[model samples]
Target: MSETWFITDEQAAQQALEAWREATVVSAFQAHQALDDTGYIEAVETVIADPATTEKTRRAWNMAQEFRRMSPTVLELAAALELTAAQVDELFEYALTIEA
Candidate 1:
C-alpha cells in the first residue's frame, strides 16, 4: 500500500511558507547554485560589475564560505535583482535542498 500525507492545502502552504524564515545562512556554493538554477546568474554578474559594489563586498562575494541573509552583499544583490523578501526566503529554502 502507498503511504499518503493527510495535510490540508492551507496547512501545507503554511508549512512551506514558514520554512527558512529563520534560515539566515547558506554555503556560498548553495547560494550560487540556487541563483544558477533560478536563472539569476547573469543578473549576479551584473551586480558584481556594478561600480557601486565595493572591493570588500566583491571579495566577500568571491571568497566567502557562507552567505548570510542580512549581509550587505546579499542585501545589495537582492535590491539590484529586485527580489522581494518572499523571493529571497524561497531562494534560501530552495538552496538548502541542493546536494553538496
Candidate 2:
C-alpha cells in the first residue's frame, strides 16, 4: 500500500510561502525550461537578441550557472518579457520545483 501525508490548508500555505521565499535562485536549465513551458522562451530569446540589451546582460544571460530572482538582469528581462510582478514570482516559484 502507498503511504499518504496530508497537511492542513493553513500549513500548506505556510510551506508554499516559505518555498517561494527560499527560491531566490534556480539553475539556468531550470529557468529556461520553466520559460519554455510557459511559452515565453521565444519571447525571452527575442529580448536577448534585441540590440538594446547591454553586452554585460547578454553575457550573464548566456553564461550564468544560475538565475537570481532579484538580480538587475532578471528584473530587466522580466520587464522586457512583459511579465507583471506576480507573473515573475510565479515563474520563479515554478522554476524552483524543477530538478537538475
What tens-digit string does per-residue lDDT give for candidate 1 at 19-80? Answer: 54545689999999999999998899888888987788788889999988767888888998
Could you give candidate 2's per-residue lDDT for residues 1-100 as a string of tens digits?
Answer: 9999999999999887767645589899999999999999999899899999988889988999989887888889998977887798899889989887
Instruction: Tell me the TM-score of model 1.
Output: 0.74
Stretches of model 1 off by over 4 angstroms after superposition = 1-23
Error of 2 at 16 (Å): 11
**Candidate 2 whole-model C-alpha lDDT, 0 to 1:** 0.88
Clashing pairs in 1: none
How much RMSD separates candidate 1 from the native structure? 8.0
Instruction: Please list the C-alpha lDDT of all candidates, in the order they appear.
Output: 0.85, 0.88
TM-score of 2: 0.76
Model 1 residue 70 distance off true place after TM-score fit, in angstroms? 1.7
| Top-TM-score candidate index | 2
